[model samples]
Target: MTTPPFAPVTDADLAVLSEQLGRPVRGVVGVAARCVCGNPTVVATSPRLPDGSPFPTFYYLTHPAATAAMSVLEADHVMRELSDELASDEEVAAQYARAHEAYLRDRAGFGDVEEIAGISAGGMPTRVKCLHALAGHALAAGPGVNPIGDRALAMSTWSPERCACAQPGGAG
Candidate 1:
């Protein structure tokens, strides 16, 4: 099982994440992805929260702009289009399956939760339920790892290469 690369979390990172989420962040393991400006874009969360609840989503999207872009895409029914593509395209479907496996493997590195076992976020291995989850996984694992995620990122208005963070040093 290959472990997904994650940056060490810091107090400043938690501060930025709290600012982005508009609440105190919890169960965060590390910063999975960050904007070019050094602010976090995606965070790696524990499978089980401090409250002992089973959490399925390992890679969580935190960047407000990226989240908004994914929301717009979902509102425009991009999920249906992507689902259709998944159903019709065998190669893409296979790639998506591999992505689901990769997601599970990565999450297993953190810990195993029986509740979320064999379950990957974004309706992976079958459907495109949530672009936010897909995009978050793509950003965390990097390009070519999640084809659907890469596609969603391509279709979205947000770009990780660009700094859209409202916090310090993000404007450019």
Candidate 2:
């Protein structure tokens, strides 16, 4: 049987990647940044959900096709191929910064609200509850209040109350 390629990311590396992405480094996520041939790459430590659990951290080369693809096995292979190219901490940080900036720039034009709603619906109960809560909020806010409008604003502000899912440990 072929062994699967998998590796743990150091906390230091995760911090470096978080800095590059301009976000708080919450868990064990890291990116390879650049391959030996100077191609861009990305690595993410796939942490569990808000509830503690185990899952695979993913790593991948930054090819055009890999952007929309999510596969654990493929991510492992790409990480292995680029592992040899990892050199200095500074090099890795720089590469991560560049790749992250490119990613952010590329996502600048996407505006799919339905996609956001789908992601928010974690399961049947969550979906039903979220939709009901949204309906209540819409009703309370009145007919002129658009749920999508509220969602857009909540997204910009990161308000948990206005979010689709109930706040952790709070009422749905």
Candidate 3:
């Protein structure tokens, strides 16, 4: 499997993550992808955290604008629509299943934490629980991998090709 490798997360990157998440980040292994503005879009986290938390979300989205856009979609009940589509579309379902498998391989690359083994974020393969997680995976893996993620990205106002990241203190 040719899963994408993570970029080295610098202290500055950590700072941006802290700001984006509004909390201190821990167990960040590497960066999965970045926004066009040179800010972290997806981060590859450890399966096991410092506090013994089994964090299954290996790919984390951190760009404020992208996150905000995902939130808008979720708030608009786009997940329910996507979930219905998953039930109705066999082709999309198969593609999503592949995405689930890909997620497992990438996390296993870190190390197997039995708790999260075979489990990927965003209710993948079965449902569309969270657009943020799907979007993060899409950004990390690139296009044509996660169908739901690609759909979400297409539906959202955010664009990977655009540098719409928010500056520190929520500036443009």
Among residues 3 or more apart in sequence or in different chains, the pairs in candidate 2 whose N, CA or C atoms overlap within 3 Å are 29-45, 31-43, 46-57
Q: Write the per-residue lDDT of candidate 2 for residues 6-72, one digit (tens) a residue.
A: 2345554445444434575443333333222222224433334234543222222222212222123
Best by lDDT: 1
Per-model clash counts, in order, read 0, 3, 0
Model 1 segments beyond 4 Å from truth? Answer: none
lDDT of 1 by residue, 64-130 (tens): 9999999999999999999999999999999999999998999999899999999989999898899
lDDT of 3 by residue, 43-102 (tens): 999999999989999988888888899999999999999999999999999999999999
TM-score per prediction, in order, is 0.96, 0.24, 0.94
Better of 2 and 3 by TM-score: 3
- Please give the CA lDDT of all the candidate structures: 0.92, 0.30, 0.89
